[model samples]
Target: MSAQSTATERRRIAISALARELDGSNPASSAARLSEMLDTPRQMIVSADIDGLVSAAMLASVAPSWNVVGLVASSSKWLLHPSVSNEPPAGLVAVDLFSLNHDSISNHVVKYGAKRPMLLNLRAEWQAWDAAVAVAAQKRLFAVPSIWAGTQGCYDDAAKADSSKWKYPLGTAQILLALLEAADRPPKFFDRHYLPWLVANCDGGVSTYTKYAANARVWWAVMAGAVGPASLTEQVFRLVDGMRPHDFLDTVNALDRERQASGLDPWLNDDWNLANSQATTIERCLRWLADLTGWRDPLLGGIDSFAGWVEKPVKASGAVYIGGANVTTKSTEAAAVASLQGARSALNANFYHGGFSGSRFNWIGGW
Candidate 1:
């Protein structure tokens, strides 16, 4: 295949593996779940193209029983495999596709003699949110997606009835506030795009999954001493310094090996619990080691600053902020301009005082 095709396949494999890891489900188990739910022989349908093969492989990673059938481009139909010709597959699962199109998707049930077809919308939901806002703002923009929780749903019903009402650990806001406050100028996307998105998302009216995860990652990152680029650079060094601790180094190496073995992207894209735990443990261990070695935070008492920032609601101009810059759109609902843009301007003023340089550090996507 072509180089681009190979790279795309690799990325697809990594994302499927990452999804399994995040949901704590293996292919056999996920297939078993589907089998129990649908009681059908799972077969994944795809076009005979290279991208279709990648999708088939990703689906097979999640649904082990899934047999792949490539629909021929010339005929617009699949050549029925001999093995299951008589009985036929029960259900066809479509992967890496969102919209309903193509004969492989549109005619799968009739063509394949399947009961129903399932679409594994594995693409991150924040993509939808960003697209929505981009359309609203009339701009061509891409958003950095989140890895803070399970990617299945828009919101965890058990966690909170309304997404807007969710509460975060204290001092979470302080980290972001600190980053914005520390910047030499307004962040590139702050005034024009990001600020507006943040205000609209955090208002709690919509079930924007990545918004919460983004907030959590930032909170944990700050707690782990990554307030901004300066500290982020330092945090990397500290993580490397962790090599001296045999236990921690071994665990890190083990995780690295696991990802390599599973053909997953060696990045923090799975399990927010693990990410949070590792950050918390690493910070504590590093702090203890620093005390012994006469190392101290040059920025000073970041944890304290975090605590101070989230202690009370912050106000500037007409906007009020709480729980890590999440604003309540409830009070501002009546006045659209005053509520959205006003809050956006206020946030811009708060976070964009100093100038910023370079791109935002998207943990998963990278800068």
Candidate 2:
């Protein structure tokens, strides 16, 4: 289905009605009803990984007029990102970027206080942080879904605690899905986009799937037309399990298989940043995956590996480096670099429940 970049006055009225039905008090409930199909067209920036590609693709599938403009590593990375511009990028949207503000997110430690989680037109309201910060907010942005009640014991309260009872870095795609589904824009042919929902809905896909499900249900899920090969996500996980799952290396094999099975181009080969980033993206992806899964395994009654102290060697590469700072590696230290872009107070990102970047195509900003 082709989605035009238009929403009727009645449509906008309808969209608004559902979200603030009550104040934006609860994120999951609020996000489920969130829709930013405003009259304004958006230029979106997303992460450079396979998930970002999928998030962009799914969003395009629904919000056709919104442009999938650029890519970055995490949401805060975009604040000082060269892409942060002075004008024309009127409606900036960020998708699939990790937004949790804490680094070294160990046990249920509230290293920071929490932001009152609420819903907003993430598509319409997002903005860059014009300042340096060790950790950007929005992690645990959504309260845990009740389905995974087991986590309630640790998550005790989302409104006041910044530390997570448990953390899983996947599932932005799923949270996006829940948004569309709630907005009366229910998706179709999404079963083929198996990775989003499966990695999100399934128990092991994320931690405390129930309590965490409440967290934007992700950074967020959208059902593309099909779950072409839901198993592919897991297979891709295992394929890159021991290695860095960067630049869609995990997906390359899966997409290649799909290409051989069907003649489609797998959609990712043409990604704006994929070609240049493949060099270093994989190694970084694998290492992060390894670190996360390593600690997660022991928590889930699996074998202990390195007791979580095995730090991977660090190197500077665009995949992890953002604006001269390492955002992912030594995550806690990857603060937003002070901007040379003058004293423009960054806009308050209206849509950041959990969300939205790629390449230096001279692609400094996302206009």
Candidate 3:
């Protein structure tokens, strides 16, 4: 099917509009503006991660006309992705792309030279609120800040973005869920299965899960009629609490059912499960390590332990490394150094950044 553009489409809603809409006491912004953008027919480019996958699926379930064109984690992939790079359709929109200090506008969107791209980005929800605004201001894009809580949507300038206004740690998926509630279309199931993997991928473990789990519950509550504009934190834990995964597709079988029921389009024309989806840093690093150093270790308690073991090689030519779940960029760097210095076993070191995964290394580079 060919892409079509609407002649009379309005630009993206203002941050002030979202700020008011999300505010509980003064619910000034009508759902029309936000809903208009949501209901716009388009092909979507989604982040190749849990939150992005969940956001797109939920969107398709609600806006039956939209299509998903690609699942990419990096900006270069966003441009060269086979589904979009060669003959991209019109009305292309990118949703929830991870910002590992990536300037997508300068990188690809500006040079796209097709129809303007619509973006729903919340990377500023990390800390650099002004950075997000900068991306939205480019001439070649139709941008709206998708942030909900911290930074109160955005800061007008860079100087004010000093620190975060976060009351609790949360993900962009929850923010989208809240906005969906405002749009009066709520997804059926806020997944629960692969929620742990995000934390594991972050090396934050269950504690990271504990910190942000309530954000999912907040979305569920909005669906249940709590309100729009998700709050920052939960002062106390209710019995019901939260552990929902914004991600869908628990299994290959379950994905089939979800698509049939939700009428969701294919993910970059492919189907996958929790194990080896979203060819991001975690998977890329794993493959690179295997090729570079040939790690054959099993889960040795955790990755920190693995890192520790790799750091101190006792006159051994080949150090046995462990792998489980953890990351500290410094530790990873040190271990990479150890791999060369102590063992001289590996030919080279492969570096990776863990920012996009919502890990402790948010926006920071590492080995």
Candidate 4:
């Protein structure tokens, strides 16, 4: 078949699947939830060539609202932008980061750059936030402050008492400090706690799943080469796994049967359950498939590393020699020296800042 014909067929299938999902029994559930209800075999339903489908616009953004939820709730927002732009625009383009990848961000900076390009990051960990800030700083890009709530102790009342307060855990505080250091200019930094206030007072609508998925698609597309195919698949699988419930699959199948039997195209069908499920399912499937197939990762890359960094040594120093004689130095020595140095630095830094000396090392110093 010709490429055009194949594209048409694929879209028909997508439309059929979506129609089935919308015709399900529930009116309140989203597509991700409906798919769980239908017991749609994940492997069977999930397009094997997801990246290609996304690129060709066979699957597109269904809602902007849900995308927003996924972005704000997750720990890593790095991939959010591309996910947004998976579908081609129907009308005038809006302000969004989904179509831009790291390289694209660079190109934009080189081309038509804004004073502060909005950066929507979902990293909940302090270190990840810091790393993102560091990159932003290196590029001299302005950050549109976003809520990253996934970090440990991130939601503490004291940590969130003031928007500017540094009372958060070391990792969280470090990220803020990094942002300040990088921008060489302080842009507004808001934690998750401060987000409700910011959004309530701001003029724009909140981010939604549809918007997030669209942007996420864009993000994945832009970073396709960087993330590779395997890694992308794993990420997509994780995304689907995270969003899908057990009942969604069964619900979708039942709904689809109903729609076809009624001679209704799901998107245009009057059935409330079918419409709702179809919309929800399409959105969830598109988002998951985009992430899984667009980016690739080698399997050998340690899955445990997804948890974040550890101080594992790359190589042992073989042996140490003292006075021309080999002397065995305990492996714990390195750890001890690091701890002692860290403590000393904390004390000295705290004294210089006129804060309580013990506060800096509270978790480590046993104070």
User: Candidate 3 regions off by >4 Å?
Assistant: 1-19, 23-32, 73-83, 87-90, 98-162, 165-168, 190-274, 277-367
Please estimate how well model 3 matches the true structure, expressed as its whole-model Cα lDDT.
0.33
For model 2, how does the per-residue alpha-carbon lDDT over 1-367 read when each residue is reduced to its tens digit? 1112211322232233333321224444434324434224655555555555444555655664655434443322321222333332444454543223211111111111222212222111112221122123232222222111112211222331122322222344543544454454533443433343233432233333333443322222211211112333333343223334252344446545755586533333422123333414423332333332221211111112112211221111112112223222233222212221211222211111222331110112222
RMSD of 1: 25.2
lDDT values, one for every candidate: 0.26, 0.31, 0.33, 0.23
TM-score, per-candidate, Cα-based: 0.20, 0.38, 0.40, 0.18
> For this target, which candidate reaches the highest lDDT against the unseen true structure?
3
Q: What TM-score would candidate 3 get against the native? A: 0.40
**Looking at model 2, which ten-residue stretch has the lowest summed lDDT?**
102-111
Index of the highest-TM-score prediction: 3
Candidate 3 lDDT tens digits, 1-367:
1101210110111233344554434433333344565566666655545445545555666775665554443322331223343443444555554221221101001111111112212121222333433453342232222222222212211222211211112333444545555556654443333222321222222233355442323222332243433322211112124424533224335545655686644332222323333343323333322232222311122222322221111122222121115422334545433432332121111112123332121121111
Better of 2 and 3 by lDDT: 3
Q: Residue 81's C-alpha lDDT in candidate 3?
A: 29
Q: Write the per-residue lDDT of candidate 1 for residues 201-244, one digit (tens) a residue.
A: 22121122234443233323333342344543224323332324
lDDT of 4 by residue, 1-367 (tens): 2323333333333233223322224342122232232222110001112121222121112211111101111111111122222322221111111111111100001111111212212111223423443453343222112212111122211223211111111111112212222222222222222222221111111122123342223222222222234432223323332443432333345545755796754531221111232223334433333343332211111122222312121111111111112211354335423432343211011101113221111101100
Error of 4 at 83 (Å): 16
Off by over 4 Å in 4: 1-132, 137-144, 147-153, 162-280, 283-367
